[model samples]
Target: MPDHLSPDPLHILHEVFGYDQFRGPQQAIIEHVTAGGDALVLMPTGGGKSLCYQIPAIARQRAGYGVSIVVSPLIALMHDQVGALHEAGVEAAFLNSTLSFDEAADVERRLARGQITMLYAAPERLTTPRFLSLLDGLLSRGQLALFAIDEAHCVSQWGHDFRPEYRGLTVLHERYPGVPRIALTATADALTRTDIVERLQLEEAGRFVSSFDRPNIRYAIVEKKDVTTQLLRFIEAEHAGDAGVVYCQSRKRVEELAATLAGAGINALPYHAGLDAKLRQQHQDRFLREEGIVMVATIAFGMGIDKPDVRFVAHVDMPKNIEGYYQETGRAGRDGEPADAWMAYGLQDVVNQARMIDESPAGDEFKQVMRGKLDALLALAEATDCRRVRLLGYFGEHAVPCGNCDNCLHPPELWDGTETARKLLSTIYWIKKQNGIGFGAGHIMDIVRGKKTDKVAQYRHDTLSTFGLCAESSEAQLRGVLRQLIATGALHVDAAAFNTLQLTDGSRAVLKGEVPVRLRASVSAPAARKPRAGRREAKAASPAAATLDAAGLGRFAALKAWRAEVAREHNLPAYVIFHDATLAAIAERAPQSLDDLQGVSGLGVKKLEAYGADVVRVCRGPHG
Candidate 1:
């Protein structure tokens, strides 16, 4: 048995996982679960949520309990997680469709012999009778240690990433009542959290909720203006040569934008479910293994990815709601380094999102909940105060202005647009009243701005008394005003009627001047782009790169190159073998011996045995 495996959480954490200490509630959660207590953990992505269960698995297994079963949602997630554990010298295996029949049987034989520490599988496979029997065998042999359900929010229909298969996971609690189970998710609002607890039958479980704030990720939502150009500029100025994910709303848009990005000399790849499964896997593999590859994808791409060096997450179109938005943007800056959550949304994004909700086949109650979530996201986007505060407040957590977000740094000016809003609403009200029809955003904006295009002339809206009433207001300003109105429920987007605007009952307040309308003034983006990472609380491209000396920089580069070659030989992501933080620490310290390497963080016994000598050689310079 490995020396790190024991009934000691801190010993396993440092000796196996190679971390110096626990963050937040990790130690507490691990100790609780290891002591046979059920838990529900809500830690943010990159917040070391995995450690909450992983440490317990090591401790419990060493205590002569049994193999821990981890119910993961994605095949990619399972593959990488198991690989990482193997690198740490822990015996972890995953049983998914990717394994051959004989290979799976071999794993089953080893599992029966109490050889594996942690085993990962999808919920669908785990719920099947054959796997259940195998689990029964393990239970009879005192080999079933615990159960870990990752992405626990999927069990709830209210969450954005609901999976019907996750509902079947209630069997874990019912069948293995004696085994402690921990349900984990990084993103869940109050309702989703409640639903997860209810559906998973974790009512008796201890709840561990960590702060949702990712202060290292700078939040910026720009008003959409040629999103492709803006995105390219943002990448070029801020994150050139860094890996990122760009999300679009549709499959067609994903492919087109990917091609366009590639044309602009970027290493971009498109990923969506519309593509062949083999091709999708290939793209995902390349994204995981290669550096500086931008993945232009839909919501389908980023569910359980554990890539830790993603520098940014850009959105060409807005997500449907706050949960989805929070989960998606949380993918960036997993290394605790400065990263960006950049998005470009405009009137169409709001309309498209609202239209999807209105047109969905869900029940009215579900639709109402979805709408409320969307409104919160819009409020975040339109907020002039701290974006971080607005985001965390949605999850029922409060915080002071994080001096890191774009809003906190720039301090957008808010203009009172009460009169302008009335004019815009009057156009909708009169058009619906006179013509018995609602008009979409374009025509209404045109009428308000006094632009007599071909559509406006054909509609014959020039003769209306409200036509061009707010000619002084720029189209951008009015569009901003329109977004706020929709967000506030003063206006509704009728999806059945070509996304036309109609006055809601809430509009009466604004029309009667009983409510004041405040809007974020339209500010032009800076023409000449400069790096924003130099600002306070922002980080460099990678951890500690900016602060390293010249010799340290050279040593860091050599270590990275060596790590890349080894990663290719092992067919794993470089970060999985050794993260940039670990390499940077090694370079900065210039460790001269194996004893010296042990003091650096992220250097466990197995890793030290595997690569410690090579790292020391790299640090000693070319002659050595």
Candidate 2:
């Protein structure tokens, strides 16, 4: 390790990033990586995963350890991070396909001269022969600092966003055995973590796994009914004038929903693989730079978005698994402010997911694993207990009822669903026995509810003994019950039969009265409604803004406006200049001088020297 790496990381953190202390295991991870040791960091999104490598990079460079090379998956992510580093007075650059040949050559020259502190490269570019030759040159000159592989979960084939190119990254360790390597990921399960370690050749790397809880995010899953109307109502009631992301599963849906939201007067944009590359980039830039802009997109939108003030993330369609759901929802409340994760899912989501799995070209084992994962998410959606507790439990963490989620805020009453389960299962069995195949939920529901539809009459199902057996229950109530049954493994969907309802072995127990079923009583539409907090209540609820009084709120808003102007001037994201948390601290403290401003968090020595006077003037206002 270089002597500069021996400096107190706290000193570097306070001077560079303006943070007084490290969060969670950041300090330890930084120390380990800076000491020329390998590490695997598993942290939730917005958990400061960047700093785990950034601080060490700066420390190593300051000590003359050479340039830190960051292998990222997205060019936009590189731009955002490097821009922030520049505003903090750190010398950073990125080389990717986006750069012109001349621009790329300039960056290369800088790297050769050791003029840059860090270099961010796309994994594809980093694995190229030219880049590898450049790295060899840097290594020969003893100017290579360390390697940071971000989005390490992409290395895992089992992960949601798997990239085959990441597998080629092992050349770093093979070619340069002395250079330390650190792999970081925002989302990863045990299996994915293991795969990351193996694939990245970090089998002996120190593993730092942080808690996967985002307490500031309130989770609510509603049954899909008139989805467009429900989505509009959610936006109007809970997230008016706030920046957010609405995730859809398909590109067409993304476009249609974006139009719908825009027609309704929400500043919305569509983003997906189908859009022109430049258009997608422009939309992403606007969302990062402006407030109250909602981006309606498929899963393509939010892999590396660094926006911190997104107040909500609404899912118009269900994700295929819990990991994807967790990673997507984790995008909200990144600044540790209170945010919402609202999703609307129904039986169709289940059918669609099953159909997708069945139609996929992946092997049977992979398909089975995917089906199991989807079932876990279904269980979470239909859970009657605290959503936070159940969600955490899926990741092997046990948590208490959060009191912030829909279930905890309004606990559902349990009803004896044994009779109901038996009735539904018997109806399915009867249909299969009589017609030689099972029917879809709708047809089965009509049979049980005694609806004489054309299909039901064509099959002569209206004359069966099971007809009208569930007339006391509404269609919605029966659907909810069936969904819960599927979640619990007593029922399943036969994808080969067009998602026909089928009974599992467990269903036999329920039908024989050997098992008792208790389920959340079905409520009407808007079952997952949460009480909307007014402005005062919202500010009071936000821990970051809680300390600010009326005057302080005004000051905070003024500071934000000034920051926005400075960001525009520098062609950087607003948060790059100063995060909302840092601004809140400054507004609450009301620092009137450089000396006083120095005490605030997030005002490092470089930033303090660069913008300290302006910040003090803004805080003091004209009266001072």
Give a tens-digit lDDT track for model 1, residues 299-328: 999998888888899999999888998899
Report the C-alpha lDDT of model 2 over 591-616, residue by residue, as the tens digit: 87788886688887778888988888
TM-scores, in order shown?
0.96, 0.95
RMSD of 2: 2.5
Q: Could you tell me which residue pairs clash in candidate 2?
A: 4-63, 18-602
lDDT of each: 0.89, 0.87
Positional deviation of residue 40's Cα in model 2 after best superposition, in angstroms? 1.0
Model 2, 32: alpha-carbon shift in Å?
0.9
Name every residue pair that clashes in candidate 1.
Answer: 66-143
